[model samples]
Target: MTDVVATTPGLFPLPDWAKEDLSDLKGHQKGDLVSGGEGGEIARAYDRVRNEVVDDQTDAGLDRFVEGQARWDDMLAHPLTVHENVETGGIVRYYDNNNFYRDPRVTGELTFSGDVAAELEAASGLLGSDADDRLQAVLPGPYTLADLASDEYYGDEAEFLAAVSEFLAGEVEAFPAHATLFLLEPSFVTNAPDDDLDERASEAIDAVAGATDADVVVHTYWEAFAEKPYAHLMDADVDALGFDFVAADREANLECINEYGTKGDVALGLVDGQNTLVEEPGTIAERVNWVREQVPGQEFDTTYVSYNTEPFYLPTSKHVEKLSAIAEAARLAATEGVEA
Candidate 1:
């Protein structure tokens, strides 16, 4: 039987405790938050918030869990956004949502100066004993990360992309062998790059993901594929490919994917993360069956069940419900059994 798994793509909304003042948090130094001191009380406070999310994910009974990215102050760019050489300017739209992120300008040779490895390490430690063995980690995809920022250091686009890719590769290599990594590239559905950039993007993905022994998933959202056939994604080197089936025109996307086919496991974005309405397991199961019907003779060893995107837009309670919905949907679908 194919293991229909449910997992989060990380970057959950900042929870209530995150909004609370951390400087006066008992057990750590106030300056710790600023300097990102690993052993201080502020670090403890950060851990407390992340653990809370981990605990919640475990409670949801998900097959795979995410760190809930509470410390990512600047959303996707995150630690990179806080880097010394990168200057932040006016607020720019974050994908297609109402949410906005400050534009980051790379003023110097981009380096892996961020503490993402530390964040990943800390999250893994917290989830190790408490949660399921399958702990999934999400990162901003290289091409998307480069596209999100303004390049001033590398005069050439290919060079800039390669630098960002290498920086991300270091982070991927540092991840614990047991964890699965999700490369979040929502921009793929929008800014479809030309052949040269597209080929570079694929190679860059391979550079980072190939360095690790862990399972790598290339996840894209914000509606379906654009007018372009998006052969770039088809050529990506990954163990799994994710698509947004909730907010997306599912019929069209599924048809296109069926025509093109995929080399990796198909991760369906089943649970609606944006809406407050919790989707029923039975309804989601039907959708899962619908997908199976769309593509015949396709052997996807591991079918990942997930939300269309991050649940940052929704309230924490609803987000928890959405996570539960993912697991429940997969459970129902699996119980029904997929007929070959």
Candidate 2:
């Protein structure tokens, strides 16, 4: 029997209180009225939000917990934009969504100085004894980061991708032993690179996966990858590959799995992250079983019932409801003997 668990593919929205605190701090900064003690106010506000998110996830009985990525101003590009060598450029729409993120322009050699690792460390402190077993570290995959960035220094795309892979490996190396590492790669489905570079992309993903002891999952959302691209993605030596059954072309993705098969573990995105409607737990469990039935003989050791993408697009109240539904669905799936 497979072990089914509840988890989220990271980024969560800030709470109303946090928003108010941050607004006040921003006002003070613009007026030059910020005091020395207030320099750490933003960090404090983030900590408060992180604590609340962790508490909510715990209460909902989610098997895996994330830092919630509340500190990220620009979801995928935050780590790169914060680096000294990179400059923030004009806003670009985030993958056909209403959300926008400033482009990270790479002007110099890329380097990692514990950007996301710091956030993971802070989140780890909240879990106490369960930290090693439940805490999940989320980061942008090399291919996604490279694709999103504006490369001025490394004129070549291949070279830029390699540098990003190496830089992200450093961040992974800095993390303490944890349960899972979700390397979000929406670009794989939204804006796939050339077919010739597929092998290079897999190699880059493997390089980062090899850096840590945790189980690495390359999670893609928004849509399903085309056949050739999906085949290339399977070449990576990561533990599991996540698929968005909600927003993706379900029949196409299921066909890919039936033909190509999958690895030992898989993540099923059953909950609608962006929508306000909450799904019934039994219905979600049925979908999980339905997917298992579609791909005959493809067994897995673990199955994650998660949101198709981050729930940042939803209101906090609805997001909490979805979390409870995910946990309940996982429990139901496990009880009903749904094979992974």
Candidate 3:
């Protein structure tokens, strides 16, 4: 029931500023060479949003985070959370001293809440003219999130996937009513045991599809899709499939596309979302054309351009701005190609 349009999928470059912010937060959390501590971007990455609201007395960092959650809708009111980082990986939530009212991570059911849904809707709205064209609502799929969590949650792999499916189903049903499709990322399907991977992946997809009113998309990257392991994804009741062509075997993706011919949409990720470079729009357009040839008669218009991955290069906010550029380029390419 969500608005449907033919638009390419992609993201822009990571801004330079995020690096410093990431560094600062990291230094604060673990200490530097001058002092003994665990060093990584985790803490600095944590700080960008953490330092914004809370006070000096509290775990200022955690407090700032909880405060953000309280006003998430207001913060997201802007085209962008100038104060928010778009990155998905990191601490999922921030809680009070007693662990009440926690801010959850993007990878779980927590993302399906009203506050997050409003953020997604606001982000889509920010695209302005580009909103009508195809854009995606990226969510972490059950399999990926379940796998990413500590093993303590589930009894075994089987039990783990089942619980994941149920958890995601609830989340799927909670997404904003207007969003066209929820692109669930299942990055860990590649690492799962061969025998169980596909079944687990399909169940996860089905769970989301059944749970939500929106379209469910199974997106995978950084792995080969044609291999037996990936074939399992074909079983999911997806409205479309998103493949990472930047790092994946193009032949395999094409093969899958052919095999799955028009059962749903094919979101071809030609732009590299993970890199900081402002890629040549021309090169991406040409690649989309080449992919069109492989599909023959599908027309270049049917294919949408997108990044193979998220811009993990910098902070999430900068990355989103970068992603915005990619979206513009792809839209132009698709419009022109369709007209031609």
Candidate 4:
């Protein structure tokens, strides 16, 4: 029985230990935030926030732990955008949410400076033996990052996408082979139709995901599977495919899964990540069971029962409750599956 792992997207509500200055820091862009230096007050606050969320997720029995990414004020565009030659541009909407990311203009060659892995290394070090194989790190997928950025140096879109993939692969190569990495690919589902775009995107995604020696889970959220170019996701080489059922039509998502079939594991975003309506574990378990009913006789190697999107939209208390409920639902599902 695969355990329902409590994993979330990078962005999350700062814990109580984080102060108002940190809250103010949230409104600033990545370039502006980085000007304060890595040893300043905001960095310390982010450290506190990371510790709190890590402790919270671990205490709640979450199977995988993220660094909480409290420092990612620019959302997924950050850390990468702040590198050597990339210039930060105007604020733009990040998916179907109020959140935004500074448009990154690739003025020069993009290179991974090993910062992404280093960001998680501290948090990973804090994890005991229990979380050795369970500590997860997050990276914006190549296609999504390319979609979010402007190619100033590499004018050719194809070459730019390949560059982004190689840049991301550098980070993937740096991560410990035992760690799990989540590649967020919201652009895959929301972008307009392009015949070659889907295939190129899938190839770039597969290349970046394949760079890592450990398990990689590619997640697409904020849209239905049928409405998007995600049908090609089956061809993307990754260990798991995660769908946001709360944002998509649940029936449509299941149909897509049944039609194409998963190449590896399945991650069901069964719990709501955009609201304050605290759902219970029993309720989530019932939803999991209902999803299972939709896809019969298919053994999902590792079903990740987690949030449908970023949980930062929910209130602090509600987010905590939602995290616990997700793990409980996974536990209940595993027990029931075993009994059956």
Q: Using lDDT as the measure, which candidate wins?
A: 2
- Please provide, for model 4 over 1-340, each residue's C-alpha lDDT reduced to its tens digit, 9 standing for 90 to 100: 6545656765677665564665565454343334355436566666677788888887778888888777676777775677887988888887778878788898998876776776677687778665558788888888888888888999998899899999998877887534578898777776732676777888898998888776788887887665345667678779888888887777777778787777557777878888888788877777777777788867776778888887866777888888888878778877754332
TM-score result, candidate 1: 0.90
Which candidate order results from sorting by TM-score in descending order? 2, 4, 1, 3
Across 143-240, the per-residue lDDT of candidate 3 in tens digits comes to 66554443342357677667656755664455444334544363543554457566776677677777655545566676656555456666667766
**Best prediction by TM-score:** 2
lDDT of 1 by residue, 64-112 (tens): 8787777675678774576767888778988778888888888886666
| Model 1 ranges off by over 4 Å | 22-41, 129-132, 226-229, 337-340
Where does candidate 3 have its weakest 10-residue lDDT segment? Answer: 57-66
Error of 1 at 123 (Å): 1.7
Against the reference, the lDDT scores of all candidates come to 0.76, 0.86, 0.46, 0.76
Instruction: Give residue 7's lDDT in candidate 3 (0 to 100).
Output: 28
Candidate 4 Cα deviation (angstroms), residue 154: 0.7
lDDT score for candidate 4 against the true structure: 0.76
Q: Residue 88 deviation, candidate 4, in Å? A: 0.8
Which RMSD values do the candidates have, in order?
3.2, 2.5, 11.7, 2.8
Put down candidate 2 lDDT per residue, 229-303, tens digits, no spaces: 778878888989889999999998888888888778999989998899999988899999989988887987999
